[model samples]
Target chain A: MSPTGNRADWADDEDFDDPSVLPPQEVITNKDGTKTVISYRYNDDNKKVKVTRRIKTTVVREHVNPQVAERRKWEKFGLEKGHAAGPSFDTTSVGENIIFRPSVNWKANAKEAEKEGGEKGSMKDQLKDKKVKCRICSGEHFTARCPFKDTMAPVEEGTAAAPGVEAEEDAGGLGAGKSSYVPPHMRKGGAGGGEKMGGRFEKDDLATLRVTNVSELAEENELRDLFERFGRVTRVFLARDRETQRAKGFAFISYADRGDAALACEKVDGFGYRHLILRVEFAKRTT
Target chain B: MRPILLSGHERSLTQIKFNSDGDLLFSVSKDKIVCAWWSANGERLGTYNGHQGAVWTVDVSPNTILLATGSADNTVRLWNVKTGECVKVWEFSTAVKRVSFSPDGNRLLAVTEKRMGFNGTIAVLDISYGENLSAQAAEPTLTIVCEESKATVAGWSFLSKYIIAGHEDGSVSQYDPKSGDQLENVQIHEFDSQITDIQFAPDRLSFITASKDKSAKLLSSRNLAILKTYISDTPLNTASVTPKKEFVILGGGQAAMDVTTTSARQGKFEARFYHKVFEDECGRVRGHFGPLNTIDVHPAGTAYASGGEDGYVRVHHFDKSYFDFMYEVEREQARK
Candidate 1:
C-alpha cells in the first residue's frame, strides 16, 4: 500500500480482483510438450512460502578441436606439476684457488726487537741507552727506513733539541718537526676553566640558561615551559644522577634566541617556581 | 560569574574569533583543525579541513559567508562557511602566522614568516571575484617587507586602507596597503620584548599592544602614541578593551611550558580586569589551568572569550553585580 509492494495493498482485494493479491505461481514446460504449475502464498508475517518448483533443463554438448584441447590440457597439467618457468643454472662445479690464506708478517715486532736488545735492563731504558732511535726523526727506527720522515709530527718541548742530533745526517727538515698540536682546552681563552654547571657554552649558546636550586620534582618540559615565554626553547636538560636516575636539583634550558635567553635569565632569576627559589644565569662556554 | 568551558583541541589554541553577527565562533589551534561552534550554546558546528600543518590564525568574512585561515604549511586558505568547502589556496615561501579579512570581505591581509625566527612579509591580496576561477592564482596586491624584525601579529583597519603590525622587538609599524609605503614605525616598550598581540580598538581610533615584558599599552591610532599602560605582574600574552571603553581585560600566567598537572590544579591562570580611564585594578577571574594565549571581547560588550594553552576556550559573561558596581564607580567619578 505504501508502494513498497507489501501485502497491505490487498486489504480490500475482495471488492476488485487484483493480480498482486493472487497466489504466487510459476509454470514449467518440459521438452516433451508437457507443463507443470506451482503456486504459493505469503502469510501476514511474510515468512517465505514452503512451496518448491523443479524444472529439468537439457544440456548441450560442446564440440572440441582435438589439437587445441590437447595443448590446453597439457599446459594446465604442466602448471599443476609446479615446474620452474626458467632454465636453472648449474652451480655444482668447484672453482679454482678458493682457499683462504692468512697473511704472514714479514716485519720484526717492536717487542721482539726490544727483547733482542737485552733482558738485563728495562726495555725502554735499554732502547734509549743503545741509541736505537730512528736516524731520520730521532725516533726508535733506522734513518734510511724511518716511516715518519714524510709525515708531520710537531716537536715537543723536551724533544726540541733531539732533532738537532741528526740534523746534518737526516733528511732535510724531517727532524725539525712542526709545532705540537694543542687541544682547545689547553689553548689560550679556551672554555676549560669557565664551565657552567657541567656543560660548556659556545658562541651560539647565548640562549642556554643555567638554573640552580631546582627541585627534584621539576620535569624537563616544565623547565622548558618556564623559559618558553622568553622565546622559542629548543631544548631542556635536567641534570640527573646516573645510578639513581633522579633529578640533581639543576637544569639547563636552551632557547633559539640569545635575547630570549638573556631575558629569561634576568626575569626568572631569584623567581619562585613551586617550592624552590630559582637562581638562573647564563651558561658559560666550555671546551 | 561562572564561565562556559569548551574543550576540544588537544594542543594549545592559537586564536579564536566571533563572526560579525557574534553568532558563530571560529577557533584554530596547533592541532591543525579549524573548528566552528555556535556561540550562544557552545555546540560544535563543523571543522574546516585540508590544512597539513598547524593553523595559526583564522578570520571570518564580514558577510559571514567565507572564512580565511593561515597555517604553518605555508598556505592561506579560504573556505565557504556553509558548505565547508575550501574555495581557494594561496601559497607562500614561508609559514603564514596571521591573517585578517578586510571590512568589505573583498581583500585579505596576511603576515608570512620568512623561516622561523622573527621577520615576515606582509601581503595584501584581492580575493574578490575575478576573471579566472580556475583555482585562481593571483599575486598579492601589495607586499610590505618587514626587514628589522618578524611581525608576530597584524590587523587591517576598519577603513581597509592601513595595515598595522607588531614585531618581536616591541615595535609597531603602520603601512599603506595601496603603495606599500610605511607610514609609521614606533618602539613602544623600552625592554625590546616580543610583541605578542596587536588589535584595533572598537573605537577604531586607538589600538592595544601586549608584550612579554609584562605590560600592555594603548596607543593612539593616528600617531602611535601611548595613551595608557596596563602593567601586570606576570607576562601578559593577550589583552582586550571593552566595546564601550569601560574596562580592560588582560590575560596571562606563568609560561605554559612549565605547567604540570599539579601546578595547573593550583589555579595559576587568570584574566585580570582594570578600569579603562583610571587604570585601576577592578577584579580578576580564574578558570583556565594554563597560560591564556588569546582573548577576544564580544561586540555587544557584555561577554568575552579566552583561549589558553590548556586547549580550552572559556567564555565569561559579565555578572549583574559587577555592572552595578561599575555604574556606581562611574557616577562617583562624574560628580568630581
Candidate 2:
C-alpha cells in the first residue's frame, strides 16, 4: 500500500515499473526458528514456507533351495544312475552334439522309422543302417582288439600303455577325431581268419583231469577192495622203484577194456584217494 | 557173505570196521560210544567210552591189540580191542581226523587237521615201541598245508610213506612222508565245490575223491593228473578205491545205490581210464537221506558202511549176489 496518498497518485514510478519484481526468490528458516529472507523480495511475499523432500531406508530377505555341489555332479540316466553324484539339476542344458543336416532333414509330416515298418528298439531295426561299431577308439577294430584301446577296457589288446585321447591333447599331437568303431567279425582274428574253441587243451587229446590223491602201495586186499567196483580190473600195479622195491608213489590199474577204462576214467579220474587225487588213464594195451 | 544189520549206535555212527576174523564189528560214533558187536548175530559185545566229541576215524592194527580212534576233540585214544577200554589218550592242537598203522606195524600214522579254519595238516608220530607204548604220538614229523580253510588230513596211504590232504576247495594234495615235498595238487574235476571224502588207491599212484559237488574226480598222484570223473544226481559224499585194485565205490546223497567202477588203465596219451562197473537205481549203499558224511569199504573188502548227517549208519555187502541182496532189500521193504 506504500504510502499511497489519500488519492492514489497515478504517477510514472520507475521502480514500480521494474520487471525484476516478479523474479523468483528463496526463503530459509534460521537456527533461531525465525524466518529469514534469502532473496531480494523474500520478506515481501505473502507465504514464506518452503517445500522439502524426505529420504527413507528399507531392508528385505530371500531364501534359496538346497542344491547338490556342482563339482561332484554327473548326468546319468541308467547304468551310471546310482553312481557318484545326485540326479541332474542343472541351470544349463547339456545336449548331444546333434546337428540339423541334410540327412536328418525329412519330408513334412513324414515318419522315417514308420515308413520302414520297423520298431525303434528292434534288433533288426537297430542293425538296419548301423553296423557293428565299437564303442572305443572309433576304428575298424573291435573294442577287444582296438589298436588305440590300451588300458581299462576289459578286452584291451595291447598291454603297452597307449596315450589316452586327453593325454594326446596335452602332448600337442595331431589327434584324430573319434567317431565310431568296428566289431570282431569285421576285423580279422588271425592273419586272415578267426578263432574257435580251445585254450591249452587244443594241443593234446588228453582231457583236463582230476588226480585227487596218491597213497602207498599197501596190500593187495586193501587195493582190491577199493577199486573193484567200477569195472573188472585186469591189473593193478603199485608203481615201485626197481632198485629199492619201495613205493614209487603211484599205482596203475588196467580195466578190462577200453570202454570199461573210459567209464572208470570218468568216474575216478578226479576221485580222491585218501585225500589224494587218483590219476585215471587208459593203460597201454599189451594184448 | 551176507551182511545183516550187525548193530546201530544211538548217536551218529561215524566210523565202522571189522576185526580180522570178521566176527566182530567195531563202531565209534558222535555219541562218544564205541560199541563192539558180534558180526554174526548183531550182538553188542561191548561198549567203550571216553571220547568227548564225534569220533572221526578208527583203525585196527594187524597185531589186533590196538583199536585207535581219532576224534573231533583232537585226541587219539588207544583202546584194547578185546576189552573195549580206553588204554591211552594223545592230545593234539586240533581234530585228529585219521589214524593208520604202518605196514611194519611199528609206526603209527595219526593225521590231524590243524588250524581248523584253514588247511589240512598231517602229523606222523614215531612210536619206537611196537604195541607197548600207546600210539607214541610223537611231535609231528612233517607238516603239510592244503591251503584251503577247511582242509584236513584224511589218511595216510601207500604204506604210510605219503599223507593225503583233503581240501574244502574240492582239491586234494599229497606229501611225501620222508621229504615233506608237495607232490601233487589234484584238481578233482574242478568240482566247483567241497570234497566230501578222499581215499588213496592202494598202489599209491592214484586216488578217489567223492565230492559234495555231486561229482567224483579220480586224480593220479604221480602228476596230479585227472584220471576219471563221475557225475551223480546228488552230491557224492564218500568213496572207496577198491582193495582189489579193481574198482572205486562212491556213496553219496540219494544218487546211486552207490557207483562202482572197474579198474582204471594207463592209456597211451591220457593218464588212466576206468570202466563203469555197475550203477544202482537205489540210493548208494542203502543209507542216509541227508548228505553222506563218510564211506569206507572194509579194507578187507568184505563189507562197507556209511554215515550221514541224518545220524544213521548203513552197512552194505559187496559179495552178496544180486538176487540175494535183492531178497534182502525186499525183506527190508516188507518189514517197513
Candidate 3:
C-alpha cells in the first residue's frame, strides 16, 4: 500500500484481504437524509489504533417529513470537522471527551518503568526515586549556590570575571544575520572566548588575499626545462582569463624549498620570453 | 549522482535526520511533509503529512520506530516510523526551533526559541507518557520551565542524562530534566557577535563550538574549557566534526584559498579552478563569498561533501595519487 493510503503500482499483487482487521471510520446518520464522517489509522503491521467508518448512506428528505428533514440537516452538519449538531448519543454520559480503543502499553507506571531500568539506569531516573531537590533553585540537584558558580579562585579587582573566562555573549540579542549577497546564511560563532585577539585570526594576522592574474612564464618546453632544474616543482600555475582560457599575465610556482623559490626568482625575474622581459618576484607577505 | 529531490519545491527544507537502524532518511520540509527515504539506496518510502505550517526540524529515536518533527505551526508531531502516520502532536506557543529525543526514546526535548527584546526560557516535554498507540497510558506528565533570556540552540545528549542548551546570553546550560536543576551551565565559547552552531562531541564531555568570530572552538563538555582553537579567514557558516576523530572537522565558508592554474598551452585553456573548500593544504582557505559555504566530510574521513553559495554539494572521494602509482609503471614501460 502507498504511504498516503494509495496502492503502489509495484505492489499490485499485494493483497489486504482481511476486512475484519480494518480500522473503521466514525459516521453519524440522522432521521433525515444526511450522514457524518470520521477517520481511523494503523501502521504497516496492521494494528488499528483508531476505528470508525464513514460508510456513506443517503435518506429521503420530503416536504411532509419535517422531522426527517431536520435530522438530515443535523447529520450533514456533523459531517463538518466541528459542527454544532449531531446524533443522539449523550457525550456527557461517556465521562470523556474522546474515547480510544485500547492497546498493550508496557510501561503503565513509574514503578514499571523504573523496573525496566535497573538501579544503574540514569541520573535523571535515580533522582526521582528520592524526593530530594534543591530548595533554592527548585531544580533537581544544583541550587542557586551551585558550586561551579562559586569557583575556588579568589576574586580580582577590575574584572567582571576571573582570568581566562570573560562572560557569555547573548546571541539572540544580535538578531538574525542578513546579507543581500547570500540568501541562506548560517554561520558558526565561537563562544566563551574573552581574549582580545580571539575569534579565528588575531589582529596581527592576515585574513584575505586575491589573485589578480595568472600568465605564462615561458613556452611549454623552456618552462619544463627550467622547472626540472629545481628539486621538484609539484605545482605550477599559469593564470588565465575566467571566460577566455588565454594567459592572464602571471602564475604561481611551488618548489620543494625556499631556496628553489629564491633561485627561480633570481634566474627568471628578467628572462626574455618572446623577447619580452618576464616579471618575477617572491610573493609578498600577507596579513 | 542525482540526489532524489523531494516532490514539492518552493518550500524550504528545514532539517534532515537519518535512522541508522533502517538506514532511512527523514526530512522535514516547509511543505508540511515528513519524507522518508532508504539510506542505503535513495528510494522514497513514504511521505507523512500533518501540521498547518512549515515543518522545521526532524529527529530520530535511537533503536525504535519513532520520528519526531517540529513545525512552524507551533506543534511537535511524533510519527510511527514503520507507518507514515503522525501518532502524537505536542503543542507549543512560539515556533519550535529544535527537537531532540533522548537516547532511550522515553523523553522528548522540544526547545521553543523565545523571541523578545530581553527574555529567554525553554519548555521541556516528557515522552515517557507520550509513547506507543495507547492514549490510555496517560500518567501525570509535567512541563518544566527553565528561566533564562533566550535559547539560540538546544538538544539532549545521546545518553539523555542532561538537556544541553545554548542561550542568547552566549551561555550553554546542561539541566537535569527530572529535577530541573542547572548542572553545568557556563559560556562555553564567547564571540563578538553570534554563535552559529554548538555541537556536542560524540565523546560526551567534549564538544565543538563554531561562531561568527571567524573561528571554531573545541571545549570540554564537563567544565566547558577551551581545548583547541581553529581559526578561519572568514566567518564560518556551518561546522560539523566527524564521528570518529574529533579533530577532523567538516566546514565551509568564504575562506578564499590560494588559487593556482596550470599553464594553458598554445590553444588549450588553463583549467583555472578556484579552491572553494579545503583543509589545511599549504595554508587555510580564507573568506566568505571567496570560496565555500557547506561541507561534510564522510564518516570514514576519506571523502567529503561540500555545498557552497555556488550551489552544489559535491562529493569528493580521495584516490591514491596516480603519479605515485605510475612510478613503477613507467619503469616497466622502459624495460619493454
> Which candidate's lDDT is highest?
1
Worst 10 residues of 1 chain A by lDDT: A98-107
lDDT of 1 at B256: 47
Candidate 2 regions exceeding 4 Å error are: A1-287, B1-3, B19-24, B114-120, B128-131, B135-138, B145-150, B202-205, B243-247, B254-290, B318-336
Q: Write the per-residue lDDT of candidate 3 for residues B178-289, one digit (tens) a residue.
A: 7777788776556333555565554456655556565666666555677666665445544555453223343544333423442211111111111112222111221212
Superposed on all Cα atoms, model 3 deviates from the true structure by an RMSD in Å of 34.3
Q: TM-score, each model?
A: 0.51, 0.44, 0.42
| Interface Cα root-mean-square deviation for all models | 38.3, 38.7, 25.8
- State the RMSD for candidate 1: 34.1
Q: For residues A190-278, could you state the per-residue lDDT of candidate 1 as single tens digits?
A: 33332431232243456678788998878888887788888998777776655677676777777878888889999999999879999
Per-residue alpha-carbon lDDT of candidate 1 for residues B1-336, written as tens digits (9 for 90 to 100) = 556666657788899988766666788899888877655556555678889999999998876767899999999998876656688899998999999987787888899986766458998888764433325447888888898887888887758767888898899888888898889999997547888888777756787888988889988877788899988767888888888547788888778465455421353477777777666666667667688888988777767888998888877666665555554566798789
Query: Residue A262 of model 1: what lDDT?
Result: 88
Give each candidate's fraction of reference contacts reproduced.
0.00, 0.00, 0.00
Could you list the CA RMSD of all candidates, in the order they appear? 34.1, 43.5, 34.3
Q: Which residue ranges in model 1 land beyond 4 Å of their true spot?
A: A1-287, B116-119, B129-137, B258-267, B327-329, B332-336
Each model's DockQ?
A: 0.00, 0.00, 0.01
Model 3, clash count? 40
